[model samples]
Target chain A: MVTVHSTSPHFKANARRALGDEQLQRALTNVPGGFIAKRQHAKDKLPEFDALRDEARDLKNHTLAHLDVYLEEYEARVIASGGHVHWCETPDEACRTVIDICKAHDARTVTKGKSMVTEEIHLNAAMQAAGIQPVETDLGEYIIQLRGETPSHIIAPAVHLNKDQIEADFRATHTHLPADRQLEEGAQLVNEARQILRQKYIDADVGITGANFLVAETGTSIIVTNEGNGDLTQSLPKAHIVMATIEKIVPTLEDASTILRLLGRNGTGQEFTSYTTFSTGPRRADDPDGPDEYHVVILDNGRTGMIGSDFQDMLRCIRCGACLNHCPVYQAVGGHAYGWVYPGPMGSVLTPSLIGVDQAGHLPNASTFCGRCEEVCPMRIPLPKMMRHWREREFERHLSPVTVRYGIGAWAFMAKRPKLYRLATGIAARLLKLWAGKTGRLEALAGAGGWTRHRDLPAPQGPTFMAQWKRRRP
Target chain B: MSAREAIFARLRHQLAAGSSEQDRRETASARIAGHAANLIPARAQIDHGAQVKLFIDQAEAVQATVKTLASHDDVPDEVTAYLRKHNLPQAIRHGTDAQLSGLDWHGRAPSLTVSHGPADPHDEASLSHAVAGVAETGTLILTSGPDNPTTLNFLPENHIVVVRAADITGTYEDVWQTIRATYGERQMPRTVNMITGPSRTGDIEQRIELGAHGPRRLHIIIIEN
Candidate 1:
């Protein structure tokens, strides 16, 4: 139900607007609440957590190395269990397949769980265009849906909104209720959404959800959720459709357990999510109540290209959002500035790969390279190095802005001649010091107004690093 | 080529990892058949008593209330007492699990009304017997069957689960092993739900709130006997 135009190409403008919007600035203050501390506590408690991460990474590696066979095996197992597998090479095929399933089922209203793949394919938009109404069941997802906004955070879809903003949205949408009802507390808001969505769950003809992991060994799609909405959404419907990327596969239940050990700890610092459901086929003949139809739509939207490329290591990501939480840039500007479904360090490398570099070249350059993301990544993805790779790609293709290209060209020319570089830097450093006579800081610097506009840049001290090093060593 | 064929072809082109397709299929099948458990945490490798203690501790850590009963007979009393203590409704819904149906609710807790079926939206409480409990994360493994409907785990305000002490395992690996032994390899029930605690969400300004579209309170009754 989220509406997104993906202003990713205008990331700088989005960030500028985000930084200035007082409401968004107020919301950004809440982005870093105890996530870092909570993850650290969990890591300290479990000594084998890192070891389990290594094992999980290796298992995913093994699966990807033989991805073709695993996909075939998974398909066979799903079919054997009385489910259908729809292979989709692009987002269009995936969306079409989902819409076809809904139309076949005569689904007027379909309930959905929080799924990034569905977001990737714009499934809700597709379904809406096909005259099928989609209802988001996750509380966070529902909030964002009511407001007609994309998910700011993967796990917490409504992370960008304050409670008051949500209250206003609820008042506007739930107009049938009394005009002066008290929706004051978080619990009250949750209960209100719960009461409203309960009927939608039962009324839904088909339920769609994203898989956290697709186990080939048992032909099961696993979903981990703190809220139990996914269970209700899938259980109460007549049909269940699982939309997932091909990379979310583990060879066995044991491999899934290894990944499970890291997902929760890195994501929300919980030892485990409240519910981890492994759904195989639809309701069996003897089953009292469950969906009658089960379908798994496997999507490959540019992931096939990342298989053997330099960005291949990114596929190991479990979508934990730890990188987002630890990213300084993400904390400063929040998710909307990245202008897409995914944001932060992982998005920096992944956005360009999914949508070409020319459209999202700014995402990679937005990082401070603090290396916090790679440190906290459960899969040990080298995010900063990959961002540098994207920067290199941008430069090679001349995708970077004219100013940036010229600046880099000037710097590279001086760097190739070390003596000239030292002389130029020495003179510039002294000139900067003279310019910053008494204050020891420049209010504005030429060619870098973006940096000095809001905060003062510290003027250069005495001399360049090379000059100081030469005098000290000699 | 169809999307399936194109995807396969693309994968083949990218990952022609110096082996024939037959060899890759063999490698994958072997791995799946082997089904290895990679690492078991030290916390989960403990004695039975320690494991039970740890399970209780971890479950309570996640805000799930727990109590050890002498037997199933005591469950009726415990369930009634919990309902009364919390000032909840005196009725509970459950599937046709033998452990629950066998409890002499008529004889012991006369006021507690019990019903059998999948949970309805109006049901205030639901009960099911867990197939296994993992001590590593204080998780209960509930496999869906005709008698143990999956809806009972959700759709209710309060969920009461009964897990026998003997079924408690040290890690999720043990639970999966038991499942494989019970269900046979590569076969499972419609759904296998591993529930750690009551439904919760931190979506509202990252503030923790329980009972988000699922049971608000999860009361576990362990059969110590």
Candidate 2:
């Protein structure tokens, strides 16, 4: 079961706490060599990857624009295929709908595929509270679930846990099994999980999975996974439930195909995942095997408010997880530090909107705006621009601290007037130079405790880049 | 209720507080058109042999096995030779393509117990063929046909896929167009499986595993000119 961390006063504190975590820090340090390197290799092979991304972005934009039409079409197709569609306005309604269905079906055990929407709604805990067992079948999710922790990464849910920690967790949890087993190896851990989950898949009364894309024309839910566990989860169960956000809808299978091409290449640098399964409906009478019933619960949960707004581009997200994989903040602190189901560039923009700005205002401010996220985004979401919009909203509502507001206001005032900006920058440089002494680095600063806590803050150079450029031109 | 009525009701409710109806309609229509245009390529064609060769090159580059067979009759012999060469056990569950039915599998490989189609997780090897091979991404599109079940491509240790010289396409768009033309607007096939190479993931410690959850080894047999 997934637990929602108490994020009200302690999110930043927890993130700072996480920064001190040696194990998490070691795991996160591998992101650059892992996702970034693989992506570069994949991109190097496909010179037309950027062109494909542009096309995919355009496609997503087009789909979001006509989302209503496509959603209706998709709903029609789903109904025609004998699947029930439930529209939910909030996370509570979505969770209630799922619970009601499970109750109606007399379901006790629900085997789940990895679903971000389920995470968003906090479904597993709710199900367990209702006296039902919702087992997360994805290896990573299962590991985290056993640990009673939420996912710390989008793609790899247990990214924060080292092999030793996992080994310990397994040993503690699987007391029936032999202790002192060689659980340090990755494959051995995978095999151990496979043995445990294989039984859950067969015995599951109900199966639930998230849709990567919902094709309105075909009324199909497209699930792309390297593991075929998703297919097993859906196929072997008596009932299958797809919990997807309303924004996941695309117009047709063809459109889904275009997005599929982008999904793997961006997420994990694969040409295609091992299993890109498309399930249209419950089992046909003639069909050898499949679920007897299927339900697709489309959760709105403040997304409609975002539509046609500056943040509307966020709905185009395919959940390829490129942003999380490449994000410096996420790479440093991991997902739990963000204190939400969604994390990284997309999460920073989204979590605040869904949960309310007051609760999650710090998310948007956690970025350096380095543009690497925007550079790697498959849908080409103007993430920094959206983040700035959130910042502006936060400021307008007086959510930002008074000191930050005054400092930013002063900076903005100086920036508007070039002369004042130059003078202010000159004075700041002089002050920094005086503070620096003969050496260029400052070990600590009086007001900048947050900046100095992690690493050294470099002292300002002789002049700004703008001033240097002007001097060179003149 | 009619799909149109349901859609309109939902739209009206969603846009009740904000945005004009005309604006919403225009935006919706434009978005639909754009998504459709992106999906439907103007020029989508099937380029057979060259595309197949490209797929083979990609599979080989990823450290997978690639071979060619002269005809369907050569399949059982080829299978036996491959198993023997790899030093695999003789008692293996054989998943055969529908085209292979023409060949006398019982007479050739008497000891082999053949499962006509599909494969269970316990199976050692699953053999099938490509419906269309896309050159752009080096992907093999394997739809659920009479001879091929989608499970065979996934639920096994080793996947041996057969690709005819005639069924290769240049791009994904080309493959989609073919699929549309083949299936029309009727009830489509239950599944359309696309396999690129061997199943892989680098999630744990950034180390790439050949088979994380699906087939560990992917062997391609291209029947060429």
Candidate 3:
């Protein structure tokens, strides 16, 4: 597990490094055109996309409001259906419970689907530490796992890695495989991975997957995937464990359907994913093949504190990765720059809070407050507001640098009175333009080195827009 | 503790904590109403035959074959003809409706088996139905039942869905409303799947390829009134 708390400083340094890396800049240049254009095209085809979003939002809000009741109801139903439900208050507890389950089964190998909660808990490392070989079965996740990196994007984990990099990783990993083999094409790479993962799917002792939505009424967990890996993971293994956040529970399948309509449209441009599996319990008495034991670990992990807070809206997130695609900072630096499991605007707000303000404080400040993330967010989490909240929390905890705090205080004192603010702005604008000259660009600044290193900031042409507007009104 | 006593004690504690049980109940009810208002739209009169035709057209557009049968008795023969048309040597997987228990399949094909259990990936084709078809997005909702196992819809190489004309709805909202009416507030079905088209991905170099994971072919049988 990549701990955001421990890696905040490293992430800030790397993001600064990323700002100077021309190769990373070139790689990210296509993201806005690629994901944004595709999503717009998809939205244009469906006029009811906004209406569907509204429905999904409402459904999620309603479910969360009654989460306690629904969770108990779901627990009863899962028990009745011959499945065990375990409540975990923290990531360590969730991992311990899963490890215990694995120990009980004497599991050696575990095949895993693409699960965000498992990522949150860093279950793979824990399982490996316990002497279990955890294999990622999803194609994209498998690629990232082979490369020894965390998932950058939620939907496309290795979206940052090009075909050449993938080929290099494969060549380095697959030693017995010929180096001169013609694996230039993506299809060939996919087929090669498919052949490799087939044996793991069949031979694994246990399987783990995340729940997209858990139906409270029926006690069933829904796992949607573009690949059929989730099905094989849940079915082939002798024991299956579903690690999910508590907020994933919806009241019924009807409610689940309402959310599903928005999930596909928001995440990818698909009406539905290729595979949407709903497993209630272990295989039935007469059923031919499925896991003999089924367990659902509902993880809280600081989510309970978020339920009634200002950040409660974050719980409505379905992990669609829409905001990540539209986020400018995310596109530039990629997921690794965020230095956590989640890597975009959502991550900036969520990672800091889940970890702590002092440890991951730089994450909240890594944004321009562009509002594009909030615009594209499916659950409509006010990301900028949440980021600002984190900023306030950072300040209160004295997590911000002393120079930045003093500079902000000095600016605030000046701005408190109108005459002083106008006088300061008038002199500053003239001085900046004098330095900028005819090009109307400032290549460097006295104090702001971070802003000038990557790109030139344009100087003000004349009086401030607010000052000009005030003069014209008078 | 007795159930009534436990309930009363919990209610009393909530009331003592500056919240009332009635207030919570009213808020929950209001939230549910608000959700229903946003999710369930005004009912629109549906032309079921036209909706089925729309799904059939979509299926064909995605390069899948379609066949319609008069009754359960005609399914085996139609399936056999389908296999023969495709030049397949052996009968692949066969799926039946929950209402198809009495249907005779003794003479039509030797390899045909009723799809009752979980689907094996080797099955070339599996048959099922759409409980309702959303013409807006050209999607099909398949709720899990005894005959329509969710695995059959995903695990096969080819999917053959049987849709009755009356089950087709115009939009997703309409479909949800219909589902709610059928299942009511209690005892809802385990799974309700909305399948739009064949599985596809543009992940590798942004090139669209069918059958990246699930069935590449999606066949539909729209039985007309």
RMSD of each: 1.8, 3.7, 4.3
Superior by lDDT: candidate 1 or candidate 2:
1
Report every candidate's CA lDDT: 0.90, 0.76, 0.73
lDDT of 3 by residue, A270-366 (tens): 6556556677777676455568899998887777667657787888988888899898789888877888778888888888768877667888898
Provide DockQ values for all models, in the order shown: 0.87, 0.33, 0.25
lDDT per residue as tens, model 2, A1-474: 123343733567878888899998988877776778777776676655677678888867766656676677778778888999988776777788899988988988999999989988899988998998999977778888998988877777887877788888889998988886788888888778767877787788999999898876678888888766787788777889999987888766666777776787788877666667777778775554567898999887778777757788888888878898888888878888888888888998988778877877888988999998999998889999999999999999999999999999988988899998888888888799889887787889998888888777889878877788989994
lDDT of 1 by residue, A1-474 (tens): 123357889998988887888877787676667577778888889999889888887888888889989999899999999999999977888999999999999999999999998988888888999999999999999998888888987777888888899899899999998988899888889988988998999899999999999999989999999999999989999999999998998999989998999999999889899999999998998899889999999998889899989999999999999999888888878898998778999989988888788878999999999999999999988999999999999999998889889989999999999999888888999999999999999998887788898899999989888778888994
Residue pairs with colliding backbones in model 3 are none
| Candidate 1 all-Cα RMSD | 1.8
Which number leads on TM-score?
Answer: 1
Candidates in descending DockQ order: 1, 2, 3
Residue A232 lDDT, candidate 3, scale 0-100: 70
Docking class of 2: acceptable
Angstrom error of the Cα, residue A34, model 3: value is 3.2
